[model samples]
Target: MSADTLITLDTPTDGTTVSGSFDAKGTANSPEANVPWRILDAGGQKVLHGHFTAEGWMDKLYPYAGTVDVSKLAPGSYTFEVSVDDPSGGEGKAPQKVDRSITVQ
Candidate 1:
């Protein structure tokens, strides 16, 4: 995590072409000890969801790597999102969400 950003994805970059299942990479410093991800199909439907855990969470950011299964979706366009786990702060708050647009070839 940077001073200005919560999480960042380093692979399957935005507006990139991909095929089948691929490795997802990023880094984050989340209180949950893990960061969540969601893969959405062209019509904005969730195709897969999971989380990535680093070696351990400290006061600094840690690296996260995971695999996203895209073998079943008849995809043309999809969004791969990685977000620092945002637990509610006891108020009406939204979770942090970052997204990458990917096309399945």
Candidate 2:
């Protein structure tokens, strides 16, 4: 992932395979130390969504980690995404996000 992006996913990288529960860790510059994330099925349907708090926030990029349970999901392809929305509600900028393809097996 590019360092320029506000969020960077370090684990379960692009095309990674996962099973059961997996850890998603990364660095971010998000609001209130809240890092939002989601998993979308191949058909573009949201399967899971939630947020995790980072170790720190505001002044710089901070580390964040969360465990995503996928045992309930059917084995298939999915997109895992992490993003930081513009706290100002898009007054003049867009949200920063990063995503990668993952397969549950």
Best by TM-score: 2
Predicted candidate 2 versus true structure: per-residue lDDT over 1-105, tens digit per residue: 455667888987899999997899999989888898999999989999888788888777899999999899999999999988466877967778888899999
Q: Estimate each model's TM-score.
A: 0.83, 0.88
Candidate 1, 25-61: lDDT as tens digits: 8777776678888888877888888888864565766
Deviation in angstroms for 60 in model 2? 0.9
Candidates in order have lDDT scores of: 0.79, 0.88
* TM-score between candidate 1 and the true structure: 0.83
Model 1 steric clash pairs: none
Count of backbone collisions in candidate 2? 0
Q: What TM-score does model 2 achieve against the real structure?
A: 0.88
Error of 2 at 62 (Å): 0.3
